[model samples]
Target chain A: MTETRGEPDVEAWAESGGRERAAWIGWVTFAARLGLAGVLFWAGWTKFTEPVVLQRQAVDAYQILPEALVGPVGVGLPVLEMVLALLLVVGFATRLTAVISGVLMALFIAGIASAWARGLAIDCGCFGGGGPVAEGETKYLQEIVRDVGFLALAVWITVFAPGRLAVDRKLGL
Target chain B: MGKASRERSARERIAEQRKLEARRDKQVKTLAVAGGALALIAVAVGVVVMADAGKDEPAYTGPLAPTSRQDDGSVVMAKEGVTAPVLEVYEDFQCPACKGLEESSGNTIKQLAAEGKVKVVYRPFRLFGQDPLKGNSERAANAALCAPGDNWIKFHDRLFAEQPKEGKVGFENADLISWAADYGVSGAAFESCVNNGEKGAQVQAMTDHAFNTAGVQSTPTIVLNGKNVTDQAWSGDDLAKAVQEAS
Candidate 1:
């Protein structure tokens, strides 16, 4: 009312035509970072709530890791996931965390693909914890696709951890 | 346009540049310190989980408990002259989760039996009724039935250790006989018994009794004192605790 550009926000409008586009991009990255964090948090929390044996058995179903390594990975992976989610939520070292998140999702995709290729009828015991094995329904493709989506979101945050409300922005990261 | 104005503008530009460099420095320092702290926390959690996850079941090697095969093809191992609660294990060798359950709780069950705290009855059956997985389960269950009484538990443990990937062909008859031979259980009779599928009928009967009569629809099921406690017992520690509470 005092003396606008006959518009609501005069300062931003006067700056450059690209400012609005850049602002949109920032908001998009912000949404992505938080979305990825929420999914990771849910993934980690679900594992925490399930019986440890279910996770252990799920990891064993992959049959990739050595017998000695399976137990520790199954036990530690969810906790690490939760910590990473917390970091992503706070945007602390966001690019680094997103890279890690992307890598984790990539590994999951690879494991699922390998299982599918080998005709292993076993199900992955992660994410939601493999429920009872349903005959003739591995659903490997669906799992891989969902993980790919998560991977995309992680890549978004890695490329542009925007200055919306992130701690990284405050620290000039 | 004078020299003083130009110099003042130059000074302002330099100040702005300096502020940017200072902000970048702060970002680097903050990131390094915070990232290092996170890495430490992750590593600490990993080490602790590893310590907790990979616990070995103390193998009971003190003495041999008398084991006998019941008419239903179930092997019962209980020290004679000791009356204790019965802990029944219903498992299929080809079931992946069954292998996990055995790995996690097998030694505990054996120890309980060896200590005469519980009577262990291993009921190996074919949980898989479909092909791919079905054949392996049937062969392994039949082979288990053919194992001699004294070393039956050893044979049982060996089968679990040698389990193949789900839907894979495994527990071939020759390997079954060889495995028995390693346990000092080999002979022409044992080989013929395994090759000819002599215990196939027994295995089939046991599977039926387990699924239909015993109401076991899943592998790696635990029955302690005639009550299914599989929901509560997932590890050696869990097994030990549940048995203590029940018995």
Candidate 2:
């Protein structure tokens, strides 16, 4: 009787193009969530394990914050990134986390752009170990492009957050 | 439509609206709690860090011994003609571990020098080979050179107090000049000396001598009576013992 309408195992379900498209979209979003989580975890863990002295230096390389703010921002950013990654892993408040992650990526892109504009040849410190690079070694374009790719993934998760195996779906979020 | 059927449909729509409201409320509450938790954790960590970093040294107000600038861009502080153990402290302004050494042993060394118990030689050198870190070390060393012998010690302490993070542009000429004023070491001559980098070559020579000739390859390398007592002189208490044992 259920097959008369549209059983998942039957041909009737294949007739709906919208369902197929949505299934594909769900899979892509799920992949983005994990990919974003992996990148964020790595970024956070690298800085967390490094000495605070180095992290402070890396933050100073940005040259955006005041000297007074440098210590706190340097110390806090890594932990916050890890927390966001955990939240993504559990798929709780995923859309919100993606939006926050996207904003962070945008800020990073802006900082790199500002540094490039100011003629400073410092490393972006995305994964830690920031400072002056050797001559002809500043990869401003590459850093920006990579961050933009992350931003795109973030956007995808923000739009399609209720993907497969997400806690959001289990909770009816 | 019949009244009974219309009434039933209206009731169903109301129930659906309530269910949607409940879901929205739950999502908002969940997000709010999560965001709040994240913020609390971050702020707590920041506070802990700030508290730890804010322990600055009180200014040394005791009698300072006579200081003489050596030809090799080093400042020696000791009683005139007093033959005592030489505590040659090799430091770089940009190095954090050097800052640690200053925090631990700086006061003890000053006290020993004041008491004529030891001949303390403050040798600031460029440990970093690259810019902008190398640049910071050189500038701070040059600024120390510009300060007259006794003032150089104060400049040394001041540089450590506000030691910038590595990989940053620090020890700007203006800041260098201003720091000297804190110890009455300011004048047009001093300002011009800092701005023109008058002791730039001397700093380079000192760095070369420190690295290439002295064979010292790290910051906070304290050579006591020609013996490296750095490990023994880790703290003020340890430094005093080391100095006494060496004597």
What does the interface RMSD come to for each candidate?
3.1, 4.5
Tell me the docking grade of candidate 2: incorrect
The parts of candidate 1 lying over 4 Å away from their true place are: A1-31, A48-54, A66-68, A128-135, A162-165, A170-172, B1-6, B9-13, B37-41
Residue A96 displacement (Å), model 2: 1.2
A23 Cα displacement, candidate 2 (Å):
5.2
Q: Candidate 1, residues B1-247: lDDT per residue as tens digits?
A: 9999999999999999999999889878777856674786578667759676556566666765779988888989998865568888899988777777776677777777888788888888888877767888888888888877777888888898898776567889989888888889878887888889899989889888899988997877899988998866667887888888877
Every model's DockQ: 0.34, 0.20
lDDT of 1 by residue, A1-173 (tens): 57646332532442344877767767877788889888888887788666666777778777788978777777777877787888788777777888888999999899989987877776665575653354677888888899999999997777666437787778665
TM-score of chain A of each: 0.85, 0.88
With candidate 2 superimposed using the best TM-score fit, by how many Å does residue A48's alpha carbon deviate from the native? 3.3
Q: How many clashing pairs per prediction, in order? A: 0, 0
The 10-residue segment with the lowest total lDDT in model 1 chain B:
B52-61
**Residue lDDT tens for model 2, B1-247:** 9999999999999999999999889878778756765675567566757764774444467988888888887989998876678999899888766776676567788888888889988888888777887788788888888888865677788998877754568889999888789889888999999999899889889888888887896767999988998876655777889899878
